[model samples]
Target: MPPINVIRNALVAGSAERRPAVLWALASLALSMLLSSLGTSIANVGLPTLAQAFSASFQEVQWVVLAYLLAITTLIVGVGRIGDIIGRRRLLLAGIVLFSVASLLCGVASTLGQLIAARAAQGCGAAIMIALSMALVGEAVPQARTGSAMGLLGTMSAIGTALGPSLGGVLIAGFGWRAIFLVNVPLGLLTFLLARRHLPVDRRGPQTERAGFDTLGMLLLALTLAAYALAMTMARSHFGPLNIALLLAAAIGAGLFVRVEVRATAPLIDLAIFRDPGLRAGLAMSALVATVIMTTLVVGPFYLARALGLDAPFVGLAMSAGPLAAALSGVPAGRSVDRFGAPRMTIVGLIGVAAGSCMLSVLPTRLGISGYLAPMIVITASYALFQTANNSAVMTATRPAQRGVNSGMLGLARNLGLITGASVLGAVFALAAATPDIATAPPEAIARGMRITFAVAALLAAIALTIAVASRAVATRPVRDEFSVGK
Candidate 1:
């Protein structure tokens, strides 16, 4: 329980000026989002260094990335519901504190095991922020401005991903890899202070005396996702009996999780949402887009640096073009979604994404930096359009009571895409790397493999587009209230 003074302060603060709340909320939430995005890119720059430092295989060190994604993805639904059970602000505060502490620990970690553990903790903190920030912003802001505000939030997120590699590289060069984690400290402290001062404290109903948490379900879900991620990550090297066993175990656990959700008194995942066609389409598209996006993210860097022989930082810069375009395009896309129904935006965005993927698939291997940059711009713009429409579609279709659950599910879909993207693309790269005539194989052979992956991603995007089109058969209700932007 919070101290008396803290309760008193919240009451007083809640009644104070509204601008402070917006500022406080945005500051903390934006930086938190930034940190999460940064985490994804920061580790890539240090892959070589960590390999040398720990004398570990590349596949082993890759868990630094895989673990964080798995932890955050699996926990999103459970954590989102937990925030509803407790309070969004309280969870946000706790999450930020934990994230900062974890980051600090990550900076000082002495072993690969410790770093992986710290990253998982960091991911936990990240889930809290991602889960609550949308609802918090929706609660605080009016309808008219919500689109712009959420658009701005999306923009900042893209920028964070854009900056991560460059920032990580600079920090690693100047002060070792640890600085990437340490950089979050000051920003986190400021966010915490500001959020505590201004975020509204809305007590929904009387707190339950003995509310039960779905601990078993959460553990089962986590273990299932962990096993799946482990199996995928391991598929690149040796597909041994052990990995096959893990994959089978994961499938069984997933089945059990579904059963638990169906029967639980207050299930962690609200399975009823799956019954809604709009939500089903939105979530399906979300997952497909996620896979496409993640696949491109992993393959783009490798193609540029390894196949094209670009420098590390330059590869980061080349990669930033996609995110930069997405950042620039997000707000306009959001406004477009507000004025028009999501179908047009959805169709256009999906088409653009598929078209861009197709364009990337055929790019000549002999092309230079400009060749790389062109494809990125198309992909990013398409992403921006898809994300804006997808978010609006999910929130608009969901009832206020179920928004948190829907959002968490959307996050899960996206993360699942990321996991599959990493796995499938890793497999593609593995296949390429395994070619027998590698020493004499044409430089374009690697490029050809990348094209194959892009083609797969394009197909996924096209399927999502098809689903979005089919969703129109049932006819979605046009969203009237603009105030529920982040709902």
Candidate 2:
């Protein structure tokens, strides 16, 4: 088989290649993305089942999900840097194997704590897969086709997210909770084989690999991120003393991390990278848009069940629509970026998201479910467009040596936005409902809360749009036909 990842091979070996090989390679990567997201969403559906099986409380069972999220949030960037320093292919292979073994462990675990630990291990594998998979896109495809590649990966992620709860439900019903995790073992094996055959060969030698490794910086960054994520998630909508303490620790850790990075000879993340206008804007916009998108997930179920009086099955159906729309939109959105240029498409996408959010904010519950679902579909589809374009822009403009870290940062921003949205916007919903106990809030109150949450979501999208426009306005160079806004 010809090398599917031939960006450097074309130059180094002077070898001709067929497009089919690239497709095969891309299939491996797309599957990796799908599995990582599936790991996240599939476990959620099994929470109740696992809780009952393990004789544990809901809070205790939640750690099955939390451990995975915490592992990914804290370790993604650090592992991405490791990929850059050592070699992406090797690290990715190790991650795949680790993830597969961890899945088996999770499935067979007899106790709750053991399962949680296995999930954390599974998360580490996911972090590597997510980080390096995106990083390797530059090597796997032509620069001009970056948007399309990014879009394909985005589509797989959406499909995984959309498929998870329903798929998990089926598996749990048929074979039990263990089946949910055991499913990944076969899938992981396939991905490993495919990736081994198709992934690009790492050409970097070991000369500088050990030199200037910033172990301290990595530790500090991971701890800081962990602190912040725990702070936002542990307290939920209620801010308690523990939340305050974690937040303060996170703040301090962040300060010290910056201090360490600036002084380090080789930083885990170069502090200077944020200086580029396009890159800076891309990361910020990604975080903001992600925050807005998360509002749909956070607020939609409540609105559907309470305000619109939908049944449980209908609530799930309606909830799936946004991700389904996103899954369908991804490829076309990528083609649009490839055709129109990432800069222009980025703005168009953000406008669509902001418009959708605005409509949702003012939507009258009198129109009922259609009123809510319509705007949500628009928001998710537009978000797919924005995400593809933004990722393409950032990765295309980034240097080859730094691509891994940049991709990790983009993923980090999105993850942080999601965690924050779940905590912060959930609070906004409760506050708007004018009730401490949202569970008992009346229908009209739920309607009010939904509207207010979307209004806040709209504002967040607007802020992201403003950032995009401002970045383009002050761009240091002329508009190019590709993803570049600024170097």
Candidate 3:
């Protein structure tokens, strides 16, 4: 009913000091992003310790990470849509509380099963937090500054990721593997308090009351994602009848979800968002960025440890380079996106990733640790540039009311890329190596696998580059400020 700038001013009028409100909101959301990102990578360093502690096989112990990934990927969309309906702040605070409790449960678990379940619960809370954090940050800042806000969040995530392996290693060595999970409790509580004190409360309106929540659509979508995750995780080794059944179930569930969403008054995921070419391109690039990042994360340790004969500590150090690079470059990349627009930035970022991947593919088998460093830094810094710009682009293309689901879509693209990267790249590595057990494989085999995997990753990045280039002419529509707090 009012001009967009008036609506924007009204939203920030809750606090006399708009600058302070923006800072606090950014800080709180950054913390949420950091914690969730930490959870994604921290447990990885402790996998062997966990396996030994539980007297379980590596495959069984992997459930600790797999469970978290599955839960987060499956539930992020539904929970994000729920955040729009109830309140982003309320959902985020609750997520922090739940994450803390789940962390406690994980710390005290006596059996591997209990720990897996706790990790799943932790992932559920993480899904809530991760899905809303970006949306909230977008809502808090003016549209013009959205890129910078997203950059801050992206920077925190890089820091968290960089810290995860190093921190997890210290915790495992000092206390135990359980200490890794236990550490989240205090951090979660702190985040909860800060979010409660700083985050803006959602003001209910006619839109909130009128939007129908699609419960059945949510269920079908969850089932689809869960089945897909399971199928992907098992595809490498368990391509049996059971895996086939899971794949079929996933297909069926996806079909049902599509059918339900088309008819629902308020779909769990609004398919209409894909109509915007910029949003679609951004989502695709987001998936490609995730794939590149996750593939590097998944494969780098093995290459460093096995091919170069680096120890665990050295491997951790080597892996930290990319995140460090990402952290350093994130803010500048965001600011650049704000000034120059996202398309050119995204294209440059993807080209950098492809170039880095190409370098990795041709790297010599017997090399110094320094050999890995340069390529990783390039890849990660490029990812930082691409991510911040793409995120800003996606947010700019949609209305304020759609932020929740659009954020969810972004998260979905990321998780799907993660799942696909880990599974598909790992499978490619294994197949290239001609052995299922890559850890124990010969140095030559490991090197070969790494080269092939990196080559494939480069190709994926190249494809994403093409998409980004093609979408350069598409204009970003202004975000509708229809749901401001005071309006």
Candidate 4:
């Protein structure tokens, strides 16, 4: 609401002399994480209503969600690198404003096309927020507290995701589909104010681009990510000719991207960063774990309703157990990581997840909803631990100067994992079910599909566990307690 200089000067003059602003700063970061995740999830509930209102098919209305995802996927990493070159504070503030303004446009748009375009803009803002929020944690909290800070942000993210569907349903039912987007306006403004008031000022220096980096790498990476994302999402559960062509293009683009990055003066992503064993393991495990988690979301509903004979409301309630568990476990998970160390905690989390997946695979349907719910709770809570540890390890491993791009890389990994799970794992479910139309599949088929899917999920978790254990052995230099915390 106030000019940047006025607020900056006021906070600078008073803060530390009067009161510590650490709590407020963390709160602002937490809110930014929340808003970014909410932007991701809250739109799905509107598709049916949007289709009816616009007289469009489900496929047509789907773009409202797809555009937002594609925008984030393509631009997230590039924006993060840009933030490093410029100033994170400036970029984050701009992102909050853009996201807020886009929400307003989304609410007021008269046509679906306009709404989709606005959603894309909002996704760009979200990309910036998600990337920079994690990057700025070092400035907001002490090294000793990084784990807890990461945990809090993780909790907020889970809460945002868990809250979106239920909140969207209420807003749409009471006001209209428009209300869902409109609600973000006030929250975004508050986040902006808190951020402007509390976040540490971006260090004043003559900033220089790493090596006068041109835009080619970013463009190439975006197109490559875009092609892969489209391949995964454009035809859900169907790997048709188009999907194959897109996949080929993505592969070629990836090869070209690597070649370009290797030659660039200031590469968007430093290829050398991946040489760190712990950091590489963290990113790879994050993707693998995300894929496992997404499989639950995709397959859980059908298993609950069809296999367990639950009603619609019961199904919704049951399906929520995973997110709720994730939200509840986040803070504790972070604390554990901080106390026992991220590498150790990461292994523990993977084991828990693997155990839960095994339970899901073998537990008989005769045991009913309890069997399904129990395994989900275990998986979610364990995932919370893994996410916090992996994130903290990865962030701490990177130098401060490169944190933004590295953080963006973490997000990109998770996004790709989600996309992969939705397509590849979804196909696995369909095949295991042995049904052309999953919607009409009998209860036995649904149950069978769920079991088979989770068996595969457990195997994936085992693979992640293998990677984590193996990474520790390969670590030439263990991650220094996040830059020697408390030293």
Number of the top TM-score candidate: 2
Q: Give the per-residue lDDT of model 4 (tens digit) for 84-172.
A: 87878889999999999999999999999999999999999999999999999887777766777788788888888988999999999
Runs in model 4 with CA error above 4 Å? 1-19, 204-213, 476-487
Which digits, one per residue and each the tens of the lDDT, describe model 1 over residues 329-381? 76677677666766788888899888878878877364666666787788788
Q: What lDDT does candidate 3 reach at residue 296?
A: 90
Q: TM-score for every candidate vs. truth? A: 0.87, 0.94, 0.90, 0.93
- lDDT digits (tens) for residues 72-102 of candidate 2: 9999998888888888888898999999999
Worst 10 residues of 1 by lDDT: 1-10
- Which residue window of length 10 is worst by lDDT in model 2? 6-15
Instruction: Evaluate all candidate structures by whole-model CA lDDT and list the values in order.
Output: 0.74, 0.88, 0.83, 0.86
Off by over 4 Å in 3: 1-16, 208-210, 364-368, 476-487
Worst 10 residues of 4 by lDDT: 1-10
Q: Give the TM-score (vs. native) of candidate 4.
A: 0.93
Residue 372 CA error for candidate 2 (Å)? 1.1
Best candidate per lDDT, number?
2
Candidate 2 clashing pairs? none
How well is each residue in 219-281 modelled by candidate 3, as lDDT tens digits?
A: 898989999888888885746787779889999999999899898888887887678788888
Q: Cα lDDT of model 1 overall?
A: 0.74
Error of 1 at 59 (Å): 4.0
**Which residue pairs in candidate 4 collide?**
none
After superposition, the stretches of candidate 2 with alpha carbons farther than 4 Å from their true spots are 1-16, 205-210, 476-487
